[model samples]
Structure formats: structure tokens, C-alpha cells
Target: MMPRRLILAGAVALGAAAAFAAFQPSPVAAREAVVYKNPQCGCCKGWATYLQRNGYKVTVIDVEDIEGIKRRLQVPDNLHSCHTAMIDGYVVEGHVPVEAIDKLLTKRPNFTGIASPGMPSGSPGMDGPKEDNVVKAFGPGGIRVFGTY
Candidate 1:
């Protein structure tokens, strides 16, 4: 009778352990961002800092010819900005906010990338409040609203 009781107790403990393991949350993989900007661009640095603070592993690359990079990446002339970033196989242009980027990642939309067009004063990295800011997505489907900040 004693041996049977001990075996039962061990089995219960094992079951509990399995349950705990199953309920544990899986670790999330860190996302990597690579940003390209002009060598003397200050706003670009600010944008990179914003990304770092928002849980993205950011790598900023300073280049002398930003236009060449944009051309290589096929960024539209209308969506040109001071900086460009590559994250999770998406292109981010200009002073796009972190919130917009989050939405982009979550939706996983079919697009070449998203852009803020120009360096808006009230953007993530630029000076001023983030009011009336809009980010647009560009792809084979054409330009569409991505998010508003």
C-alpha cells in the first residue's frame, strides 16, 4: 500500500510539472532594424534612438550618398526622406513613428514599404508634437494610408 501511494504522488508531481511548462509563455525573438542615413544627419540619429527605446535592435549606417541607397532600394521620389531603415524585410523611410511601425509589423501587409514622405516637424525623431502626422505605404498596389500619428 505504501509503495502504491508513493508512485501516485510522483505521477501527480510529474503531471503538475508538465502543466506548468505548457502554460509558460514562449520567449519572443528580438527584431533587428538597419537604418541608413546621411553621415551628417542629426534627425536620423534621433529616429534610430527612438527605435532602440522601443525594443528594436537598431544598426545605423551613415552614407555619403543617400540618394544612391534610395535608388538601389527603389524608394519612390515622392516618398524620399533623410533616412531609410530595413526591418523584418520592410523598408521604412523618413521620420516614421514607432506606433506606425508596430502596426506595419502586426498587419504584415503586402507592400514594398512605408514612408513618412518628408521630415515632418512633429515626427518621432523631429522636433515638435506628433499631431496630424500620417505615414503611407507604397507597393505594387500603389500608395495607401498606413497609419496616423
Candidate 2:
């Protein structure tokens, strides 16, 4: 049989664990991403999949007028990509890396959004040997080189 002190100590420990668990915060919900892609663009689909794999709740819409969508999103001609995405009120164009996306969300800046510009080989969706990706931030104010990854 266990001693009284041992039993009392066990009970206290168990209670403390339960209390700690009860006060623990719940996990945050996944971020929502709405992707607009051309029906025949496979790379765009791959990008959506990449976002899902990285914890984004993605919704893909097949639109024939992808360029129209880009224009509506204020994506400059130079920043156009195969697919367009809206996340938390920011436009994400082309194959943007998860790290860049996270940084954009964490630091909400005054810009239309960020873009990887052209679909460079080896980007998140496109397949090839990894390349140094150039991501830029653009708005009416103009473009600023965001980073290179």
C-alpha cells in the first residue's frame, strides 16, 4: 500500500496538471486562402496544394479570365503569374514561398501585396532545380524588392 504522503502528493500533481491543461489556449485556426487559376494551368493547382500542405485552408476557383482577375487584384503587368490568391486582404501572386507568405501576414505593410512575379523554375509549385526566387511588394506607390529566397 502507498503511504498517505505519496498518495497526497500524487493527487496534488494530477490536480496541477489538470489545471494547467484547462488554462491552456486552444490552437489557432488555419489561414484561409482563395486561389484563382486558369482551368488548364497545372502549376497553379500545384501551388494551391503547396499552400494546403503548409496549413492554409485553400479554395481554388477555375476562371478562364485569369488576366482579368490579375488586373482586378491590381497585379501589375510585370507581376503577373499563372494564378492569383487573396489571403487576409492581400494579394499573393505566382509561386510565393510559405516563409514569405508568413512574413507578409505577420508584418502587414502598406502595399497592394507581394508577388514572385514570373513563375520562375523551382518555385514552390513549379518543378525544377531550386532557384533563387525574387519576391517583390507592389502598390500604387510602386514596387520594392521584398526579398530573395
Best by lDDT: 2
Global lDDT scores for all candidate models: 0.89, 0.93
Instruction: Tell me the deviation in Å of residue 4 in model 2.
Output: 17
The estimated TM-scores of all candidates read: 0.81, 0.83
Tens digit of per-residue lDDT, candidate 1, span 24-110: 985865689999999899989999999988889999999999999898887899999999999899999998888888888899999
Query: Clash pairs of candidate 2?
Result: none
lDDT of 2 at 142: 100
Off by over 4 Å in 1: 1-26
Judge candidate 1 at residue 144 and give its lDDT: 89
lDDT of 2: 0.93
lDDT, candidate 2, at 12: 100
* Clash totals in order: 0, 0
